[model samples]
Target chain A: MTVKLYDLAHSRAGDKGNTLTLSLIPYNADDYELLRVRVTAEAVRHHLRDIVAGEVTRYELPNLPALQFVCQQALTGGVTTSLTMDTHGKSLSYALLEMKIER
Target chain B: MNERIRIGCGAGFSGDRLEPALVLLQQANLDYLVLECLAERTIALAQKRKRQNPPLGYDPLLERRIELLLPDLIARNVRLITNMGAANPLAAAEKICGIARRLNLSITVAAITGDDVFHLLSGDEKALETGQPLTASGPLVSANAYLGADAILPALATKANIIITGRVADPSLFLTPLMHEFGWLPDNADQMGQGTVIGHLLECAGQLTGGYFADPGMDVPGRKNVPDLAHLGHPFADILPDGTATFGKVAGTGGLLTLATAKEQLLYEVMDPSRYLTPDVVADFTQVRLEEVGPNQVRVSGGRGQAAPGTLKVSVGYDAGFVGEGEISYAGSKAVGRAQLAGAIIQERLRDRFPDLRVDYIGSTSVHRTSFGEYPDPYEIRLRVAGKASTASMAALVGEEVEALYTNGPAGGGGARKYVHELVGIVSTLMDRRTITPQLTLFQS
Candidate 1:
């Protein structure tokens, strides 16, 4: 089932050639370890490359535990998969909201 | 002689529909009927009415309603205290008195006014956001802060059966007559608490009873196939002289009153529960309890007391921003996805051209779609954009883009329309004294 995408991370340094530059936001140690065990770096890079059209840089699981993402600007072309809109008409920093499993 | 003085709090402003809210008072059935309708925005409307007409310049609907129901009310001998005097309450009262005289009924109508403080403010610019001299924000649309009910005492003392005012707080409307009848001092903490709780219970008419309750199963009076909802609409309170109080919406309304609905409204817009501040008193909402008194009414009691801080919350709404609405449809094979692409294109276009347009997307759907988890997929999307200034221009720009959607390419040929933008103000004012005796005038027909 489609779920709310939480633990969002935004692009840190603008990477032009890299198809998937990593964006990392501080995360909990437990959650970081959990995602690492479930989701792999290659799977994320491939999924991101289809939308980002950039090379996937190496994944960095920070010691501080953070929301790690293979990043790109929000896609504008082709078919749309899922859309999340804010009521206040402004882009929010991914770091501001916490992601949780919908009960 | 109905020794039991029942006070009903009337919400909203409808000069035309005013009688239904106050009809019970016609027979000395109740001692007081309080009509409340003066939000920061409504005050602005009142000012606009004054500019358009010399006096009694409101919607005129309430006045018309009063004219129709005056005979019955007079025969009933019920007293009324209302804030129906928007821009010119005195003018409104004059009109009511005229109506009374034409019917050969000698009724006393009194008006309480002059709380409009927009002109009295001097020095310090009203800062838009704590800037410059404290007063230099911009031209004030409406500057009437929620004043204490003490101002109405002067008018109530006139022994005029009816009292009218301009922009009184909702709770203060019900509490004013109580204060006058009970001779409760402004500083009387216990009485103040009692009155405050009483005001909350009656403020929403049937709302306290079962109007907005949570249980769908509970058989609410009016909703339960009952008739003459009016006769059943009686909200009562068991208030003590010490300020301890419990109350519920009487009966005769079609709604439910459960712990959920009671708690929801109880927490509605309250900043500090321990000190639920109002113009009348600093009340405590934290310890209040809600119990089902009957099928319809819910008793609210046990509110603690708190010392009020000096600052008064003045709702001041200024031009926050402007919003624009437009629509687009998808008919192609990948209709939904194509519509999404259109939204993206519009956003891209706005960013490229204005670089400042704040746009948001809202999708509307008739059928539920499982693609987005539990929520259904929206067939049509409503796109909105708002900005700090030049909202009209932004709205126009969006309108232009929407019209071009048909000619530029695909994405359905849905039309675009512009909506109006209006904002008011509510600011907090600090006052050293607790009470003020306002000027009262009686107009007799």
Candidate 2:
């Protein structure tokens, strides 16, 4: 069954320079491996391509059943220079949650 | 000394609520309360203020926060540590001592300086990412390196009631007490890394305690309950001699602490799990474990570390021109269409002046950006356009275009707001740690 990533996991977004780091953690411990397999870096890059201008790299942590994706060149000059209201990219984690995943 | 020490966070940022911190001081038995109020560009702003007036660079809320919590802190004998001094630690310390004197409280406040490397830095220093020299990145305002806990230890050893600092690493505020209490060596990477992890978790205050963790039905485990964020409780950590820590909040406080929240905060802003660099230690968060030992209490352990970075990260702020923004609301029938039309009108009108002007439909794709595809026409939509330019007048053009849309473009548009402000751009660079010498100044009241 298809479900939104929000239904499977919760995440937080933080930024450094032009990079945005989003940490995606599953609701259930059992769903970690499934998410690890389905939510590839390319998949996330494709999902957020409209906003992010650069590459995406994913790091896995089985201990916490979490995936941290670093989106490079994501912020349009980051907090001090970005023209957008959400300069910190604090709301971008919701974008990651909006991605669809197979349940 | 206690085998386990309790460290509480009073304020997460400069503007965080004071009541929660007061509640923490009155309720929780803590050895230290650290307030992390400085951000990447805060010191730059403070420096600008200090230039305007030599003795006015500290946080605006310094007096109010100290007034509210001073008597309680004095009576309870809990030490206070903060980077709230911003650009002027000496001035902040004097103000704090003055406050204590007025209250007839005997307290020793120490100011830790030397984070400011503005005079020591040269214009030829290259940025870490852009490889462009600092001279090319506009006129420099301020440059402060992220000092480690070592800079704070000497002041802590003096047994001061309050320690004020400027531009120290966020985690160093919390780690300094741990090091002072446990007599941990400066090169004890494993312990420093563990302490950094604890600092990182509590650094955000209520974030791990459900302030930012609650998402209604989405947050896992026990966080689904609606949080009373208005009375959100601050966070505290109980650290043992072996680098293990347990995070919790005061009982009956308005937040929840779970393994899920801990895990989320554990990775907050972390770029690499194996190499989380700070001025003190290169922490490894990969092996860290989180276990809910009890309700609203999570035990975290297993943080590994390697040698600290030879070079320190310096946040250099410079002039980045100006930004202008304007927003107008469209509602009722065809609200989305009206907002889109309004956006089109601004884009067309300001094409020449603001070639890079960006428009966003706040009610629809402004945040997630079409990841969920189109939504049904909303009851209301806010159309926002923003752009950057070299001068205030040029930046004002972007907002002016949006205001013109009231009569020139879409129908049912109302409540227009426009703003323009100067921008301070920040860039990161590396400097040799040995050159920067941190000093401590002690004051008594």
Highest lDDT scorer:
2
* Model 1 stretches astray by more than 4 angstroms: A1-103, B1-3, B12-28, B56-61, B102-104, B123-136, B211-252, B307-324, B328-336, B348-356, B364-376, B385-395, B413-415, B431-437
Q: Candidate 1 residues B1-445, lDDT tens each?
A: 2223456544433422343454344432455666555544566666756766777454356566567657766676667776677767878888888888888989888888766655645534343324354334334555555656777777777768788887666677777767776677878765666677667666655544433332223233322233343343434444444444445443433344544344434543333445667767788654566665665445556655555446444433233334444555554355566566666667777665555554444453211111123344555555444332345676456656755666774556454544434333333344333333356888887
Q: Model 2, residue B161: displacement in angstroms?
A: 0.6
Global Cα lDDT for candidate 1 = 0.50
- Each model's DockQ score: 0.02, 0.69
Q: Write the per-residue lDDT of candidate 1 for residues A1-103, one digit (tens) a residue.
A: 3222243221122111111233333223355554554345464544433234433333433332333343333222111111223221112222112222322
As for candidate 2, its clashing pairs are none
Where does candidate 2 stray beyond 4 Å?
Answer: B217-223
Each model's total of backbone clashes: 40, 0
In candidate 1 the C-alpha lDDT for residue B199 amounts to 77
